[model samples]
Target chain A: MVEPVLDVKGLEKSFGALKATNGASLDLRPGEIHALIGPNGAGKSTLINQISGALAPDAGSIRFLGTDITMLDTARRARMGLARTFQISSLAQEFSALRNVMLAVQARQGTSLRFFRPVASDVSLTEPAMRMLSRVGLADRANVPAAALSHGERRQLEIAVALAMEPKAFLLDEPMAGMGPEGSKALTGFLDGLRREAPILLVEHDMDAVFALADRVSVLVYGRIIATGSVSEIRNDPEVRRAYLGEPA
Target chain B: MGARETTVNVLLVLLLPAVALTALFIGEAFYITLATRIAILALAAVGLNIALGLGGLVSFGHAAFFGLGGYVAGVLATHAFNMEPVAFGLPGTTAMPAIWLVAILLCGLVALPIGLVSLRTSGVYFIMITLAFAQMIYYFAISWPAYGGEDGLSLSMRNGFPGLNTAKPFPYFVVVFVLLLAGLLLFHRLRASRFGAALEAARQNPARLAAIGISPFAIRLVAFVLSAMITGLAGALFADLNRFVSPSMLSWHMSGELIVLIILGGKNRLFGPLAGAALYVLFEYALGGLTERWQLFLGLVLLAVVFFARGGLIGLLAGRPRHG
Candidate 1:
């Protein structure tokens, strides 16, 4: 078997008296979309934060591409090809969508210290940013401010931004969280197409989409992974139903 | 279409000095002198704009860099005239380039420490910390007796500029006008660079910037230092133009005025600072001559603009901002 692209063992985090994550562990292999399903306060976002270097874990190790990345900062992790999408839509509201993506592309390309040259006029940045926007069906909205996009469109833009990084894996925090039925359907198709490109660690509450898209499903309750297996296996587990599924099989 | 835009942009830049010259030749008076002041002040405001407008760093202590730059020129010339060496046994030089270099270096050095400490917090804290640091410098300048303290130092003659006589009004105006143009051009170029985009991104969503392989704090610090350096250069020129340097240069009021210029013209626009400075000086000239309580009117106008006009003069004239 190929070595896991991401390996987390006994990762832990706490907020004073409240434990957010406790001995949480996950492993994602290359070209696999792993779904992390849990109730509110299940520590899914905290796990993603620790893994993405947004938050330092209290204990355990996080390894990416066979190197320990537990001590690295968020930017270092991103430079190492780890990318994340915020749970809330956080975008450069004033900038055009094209400019926003170009910013991400600019970071991966080279030093931004080249004074006396107009970066916006450069084909190198604009071309790829345009292509990324088109990929997410936002090509027409390229010139529009990011704040003007519809809720679903902004979510798609977030994905496009992550794609610009050419990340090894995407830690998406609820890409479908606030979407309507049509938006969810569109995003489901988008993710289905994206799965062929890279591994994704998806923290989502949409059960239907999780069952539909997840290559491997993990059930989390109170920050700990209670069950991890195929859909059928997870469905058949009695403890998972009472604790997470909230119903007997 | 893009080629057309690039050409228009270049042409627009070239047109400014031409317009400035016409203003100098046609409107000949102390008003021409007033115009010169506006031009130099605009240069200073433009420098501050890079940090405040583009980088989202509201530095209230920028006046400190401004004052330091002016002091560099004033002190150097004063010592050179007296044939005395400045501190550390360095002989004073009347050269403008050397003065500018020293000013840039000094401002950058001071900005580094200030940025390092201030960058630890952002938003209101950043504003207050920068303002506080500026006030500290202002107080220090007031207390320091070596440079005439609150009384300030005066330059009887203009410092040497190799090709031109620096004493003549029209020639001096030309020199300052050219420098102002250069500052404006440099600002435009800097705004369009990759570092600029990163700085803008840092302003928008720092967390997102961090997730894109850049430390927002580091980016902001670099921008802050560069911004201070540019503003310092303008300050040096400002001192040379007036042939005076004093604690007023370091005042918190000067810092507020710098911000006022940007906001009055338009924030983040290429010509915003220029337009703002022009209007401010004109208002002061016109209002000071007309009424004693002109500042009260100025205050009322400023409040109205802030409340009603989100974009300043440049925005009204140039239309909406093209960039984020």
Candidate 2:
């Protein structure tokens, strides 16, 4: 069996009386896209937050690259090559698109403490940043501020920033949330090939993208993984069809 | 920077020294003193801008550092004049360079703990905590009779600078002008550096910065300490200018004034503090000559700027910034 790139076991979270994540366990293997789909308020975001170290799980253990990262903070996890994108587009709005991506590149280089040289003139940061921007098809818009980018363009920029992290594993939460149909189709195609770079744990509402790109699918309902299997098995599973697909059993 | 801003910055850089030198040549010593005052205040505000403008950490107690710097100079100069050892049997020296070095190091030391506690909370809480820290220092300075307490300490003469005679208003103004230029240069370099990129990003979205593996707290703390050091240096110069150091230097009003200077010139803009200081001093001079209640008019102008000219003087002159 392939050693998983990321492993989460028995994750649990509670907000007051509501259980946000309840005994959830999942993992992502190398060179495969793992799509996690659930209805709204099924605690998908909470689970992602816990795995990414944004929120601490009440009870759980997460191992990434075979190291126990359950107690790490978000920045520490990121430095260890765990990169994630926000469901909401969060970026340095005033920074140029190239600069935004360069932030990730700079972080990856661990030279954020370098205080004297001009960042704009640093080819070590700019070259890789520009390459990521071109890959995301935002090369021409590199000089434009993130705030000025189109909605679809901003989503692409977010991915570009994440790509600049050189992540070992990607936890992309709702990457297609605000993208248009055409944008979604294009990004689905892009994400399909991105698995070659790093294994992805994708949380998406776009079922077509999920089904089209996922090597495996996990149906999460009310903070629990009801089923994990290949796309065909998840599509035909009676429990998944009834609870998530909203089909009569 | 755009051509327009470059031109404006050049003009600002030239205007102060030009006016002061002209005053020197023409024997208008009072104008030279006024120019010195503007330069010192602007330098202090420039220090505050690093934290408040770039890092978006609104520190309301920067006067703590400013006054700390002042007291360093005052205490050292007093001990030197009395020929007494200033603690640890270390002889006090009136050298400007040595005083500034001690002031900068002490302020950085003080800022570390203050920033460690204050950066934990942001927005109004951050402001209140910083203000509280400054007020604590202010009261301590008042109650501590060893350094004159509320009566304040005074230097018998302006502190010494190597080679140059700082006793003359013009030479002293020259020293201050050079330091102001250095401060602006530091601000420009820091604003363009990789650390600056992270600081600005931390300001815009700390979560995004953290997601990319940068700790916002670390960035903010560094910025805060650096800011305090710059402000502290300015305080040393300010005390030498007046030959006096008092708790009033650490007062909350002084803190508020530093922030006001930044806003009046233009927050975050290079030369914002200088422009604001020039305007503030001009108001003080022009208004003080006319009426005792001049602050009323200053208040109105500040209101107008806050209401109508959100960008302050530089924004009005150079136009809206190309990038935020």
Candidate 3:
């Protein structure tokens, strides 16, 4: 059997007395979008942070491509191909969209330490950065600053930056948040195509995108997985309907 | 670039050469010395600008590196004069290049620990930790008696520069000018390079930098060390300029002045330090000539810059920033 791209087993994290992520275990096989869904305060982000190595797990381990990465730092995890996007838009606001993506390209190329070459005119960095932007439908906005780009455009640019990394697996935190219907639909299409490049551990509040793209879905309630199965199973799960979907089973 | 930035860039390019020409044409040693002072101060501030302006580090311990550089020059020149070998049995030399090498290495060595510790904290904590480190070194210099202790040390004559009579103010000023331009070019090139991109990215959003697989701590530390090296070299020139080195070189006020020059010029603009240093030196010169209480006017001017001229002299003179 091929190893999962990302595997979390018995993960536990807390804030003082609050159990933020409790015994959460999941896996993402190659070419699959494993959607993690929960209501407010369900610790979805906390779980994602632990897997990305931003926050430490109180117990349990995260294995990426069969290597334990529970104690690794964020940069190390990213270099090991566990790429993530923040719930909030995290970008070098002062840098142009092209420059922002070029930063990721430079990281991928391992040339960020090179000080003499002008990054702007470097075709090696720019060409690939432009390609990432074009893939996200942001080729026209390449020269605009990240801060200057609109909300949807920034979202697209974020994916472009992540794509520039050529990630082995993706950890997306609410990638559909604040996105309009058209943006969400387009992103769903993009993400569907993205699963072929690398598996994704998706934590999103947008159920439509989740159901449309997720090959499997897991429901989280009060920091523990209540159910893990197909989209119809999660939709029919009685407790999930009461606690999350606000409906009678 | 905006029309204003282009104009500022043109003026920045012209100002130094114009100063050199006017001083030589007039044949005044005082003017030549003043120009040299500007170049050295600009060079030092350029170093501080890498951290404060570009990297957004706001380091207050840079004086430690600067003073260390000045002392390297003073101590080496003194040892060379006395025909005494330094503690390691290494013969001391008055060669400018050799002194610069030692100063840079010394600054790097010292800045490593300081950067390691200080980079752990950020914002006000980072500022205070750096300031505290500078004060520790400052107080140490005050009590070290081997180098004249509190009294300070002086070189018998200005240090030697290869093929140049450095004792002459014009020749020394030219050497300092060339170095100042080189420093500026370095700053210009670096801010547009990959390293600069990472440093700036670290400044803007460190988490984002990590997500892109670059460690912010490593980039900031490299920037801090490089900043120290630049300032250290400038400090060596400053010691030669005065034919003296003292604890005053390491004072907290010196650290404050370095930051002031960067802010007064404009943070993150290429030539902001040079423009800011020019304005500051001119203020000190003209204001001191007018009154002993020029500090009041200087304070008022700095206040105006802080309140209204957020971009400093460069920002006001230049148009809006194109990228950030």
In terms of TM-score, the best-performing candidate is 2
B1-324, model 1: which lDDT tens digit per residue?
134434444554454465556766786546546767888788888888888888888888889899999999998888998999998899888888888889999999999999999989888899899989988988888888988888998987878788987786667777788888888888888888888888888887889889978888888888899888888988898898889999899998999999998998888777778778877887898898899888787788788769877578766555566653
Lowest lDDT 10-residue stretch of candidate 1 chain B: B1-10
lDDT, model 1: 0.85
The residue-by-residue lDDT of candidate 3 on B1-324, one tens digit each, is 577787878878678767877888888778888888988999999999999888999998889889999999999998899899988899888999999999999999999999999999999999999999999998999999988778889889999988999999889988999999899889988888999999999999999999889999999999999999999999999999998899989989999988888888898888788888898899999999999999799788889999999889988888557772
lDDT of 2 by residue, A1-249 (tens): 999999999999999999999999999999999999999999999999999888999998999999999999999999999999999899999999999999999999998887789988889989999999999999999999999999889999999999999999999999999889999999999999999999999999999999999999999999999999999999999999999999999
**Residue A239 lDDT in candidate 1:** 88
Ranking by DockQ: 3, 2, 1
Model 1 agreement with the true structure over A23-45: per-residue lDDT tens digits? 99999988878999888889998
**What TM-score is obtained for chain B in each of the predicted models?**
0.92, 0.99, 0.97
lDDT score of residue B3 within candidate 2:
89
Checking candidate 2 for backbone clashes, the offending pairs are none
- Please list all clashing residue pairs in model 1, or write none if there are none: none
What is the per-residue lDDT of model 2 for residues B167-273, given as tens digits with 9 covering 90 to 100?
A: 99999999999999999999998989999999999999999999999999999999999999999999999999999999999999999999999989999899899
Tens digits of per-residue lDDT, candidate 3, A88-152, equal 88999989999999999999888878877888899999999999999999999999999899999
